[model samples]
Target: MNQNEAVQQNSKPRRVSKKKGKALNNPPVKRLLLPTVVYLIIATQIPFIVTIYYSFQEWNLMRPDKGVTFTWFTNFIKALSAPSFYEVAMNTLILTTSVLMICFVCGLLLALLMNRNFVGKGIVRTMFISPFFVMPTVSGIIWKTMVYNPSFGFSAYFANVFGVAPYDWFTQNPLLAVIFIISWMWIPFFMLILLAGLQSLPMELIEAAQLDGANRLQQFFNVTIPHLVRYIEVVVLLGLMFILQVFGEIYVTTSGGPGFASTNLSFLVYRTGFQSWDVGGASAIGVITVILTIVMMLLMFKVLRRMFKEEQA
Candidate 1:
């Protein structure tokens, strides 16, 4: 009996080792993973390769007889040097920054408000979330037609009540109009993330803070803000990424301008490729935008990593 027990103990390690070996060399997992990886590579690489190839060649759809000529860095140089590019870049920055700031503040406030138990809380939360579920094109149209239209719209109706003339929002402040529409749509998304973070806070910590004579504002600044740093980082980075590619709202509402007043980098790319028929230049712009986005993400990741390390330390 003692010899049999010794053999059983000895066999356990061997069995575990065999299982580990099988896990490492699992045929089914390898088969599944290999095709998924190949599919991703093909899907991403094909468009990227095509875009890079086109960026160095001059190709105008309107003048196909001219033929595609290799211009090397000419398209990139032209896109960078164009005066309108600066305006569009600046507009993009302004729109993204404005929307992020407004949405973050409003979303945080709403999240804090909703964290408390209140009557009709479910209904209010549902209403808040509804805007985010609306299609972007439909949202843009609704804002343009129902809210911002100078004539026979909500703005005009409100103006009559207040004894003021109706203002054409898109014409006078196209960027602001677009920003407002986007912020309204995205605030709910931010709120949901922030509310989840708020809900996850340990009640003991909050109660302890209150017992230590921390008022609501002090507790918020001292306790709440520290706990939410990671969540805030997520919201900002993802929000910036999506906002940089804002096109539908601009396309539907402003069409990049009365005169390039609201044109962002994405909209500029669209206009260059389709409207100007300069595929090479548009491709160059597209590549540059992708590179810039990658650089920004890298910087953000590095900063966040350092912050996390410091916190851990």
Candidate 2:
């Protein structure tokens, strides 16, 4: 080829490459996306930063006359040593663990049942999922007034018909009562997720298992549960995130009351900040809670990662 023609050909390709690169740059999407990122950072991080700052200082709104003081580590130490701290921690552990266990097991069973082709399946599924849509506050109030109330509730009426007094569930077994309420509210959530997982499972693999003389139970244990590890992990992590912040139910039903019987970390923080007006102490608790939650998430992610690797292998 002539030198001038070759140069023109090379220059044309470069021009086209530049045009393609320009077309790939999505400035409008970036412009819309970056502001959202900035807004989220500002909205979430500012309060977190403020809480951390106050955690190191002594500021009790209730005792303003005593004046604000910078007390490093005192609030943390006090929170640790407080007589009710351990009770609150235990309550938190029990509440989270019990609710998760109940929800997971019940959810799996319900998902399995719903997976089958049966009459009225649509109605059953709609009814099963309805509770999950109810607001937590409303759920708590319904349980408190319509179910558990000893004076004029369903249980009371039933007991009256049998000539026996209704047992006061909240007063007698506060933690268990809270667990039941929370579990009822959360089970359908897990059920929906697990049902989706079950439906998405490969039918060919299931048929192969059946051909290999694997019964339903064996296939479920060996094939189904293994396939659902990732889904379970998703449910667990999301459940923990929401469960750790449980407040409305406790607020409506127990008020963390009759002592620290049902008071978890979140309730304790609320009580400290708003009720007791110990802003610094509450901030310290909030910081500790954030740390604990982060640590828990990291551990769970590590375990799930290992499980994922094993499944792949």
Q: TM-score each candidate.
A: 0.88, 0.88
Candidate maximizing TM-score: 1
Per-residue alpha-carbon lDDT of model 1 for 119-237, expressed as tens digits? 99999999998988888888999999999988877998999899998988999999999999999999998998999899999998889999999998999999999899778888887
Q: How close is candidate 1 to the true structure, as a TM-score?
A: 0.88
C-alpha RMSD for every candidate: 6.4, 7.6
Off by over 4 Å in 2: 1-32, 161-164, 303-313
lDDT of 2 by residue, 108-154 (tens): 99999899999998899999999888998999999999989999988
How far off is residue 13 in model 2, in Å?
Answer: 16
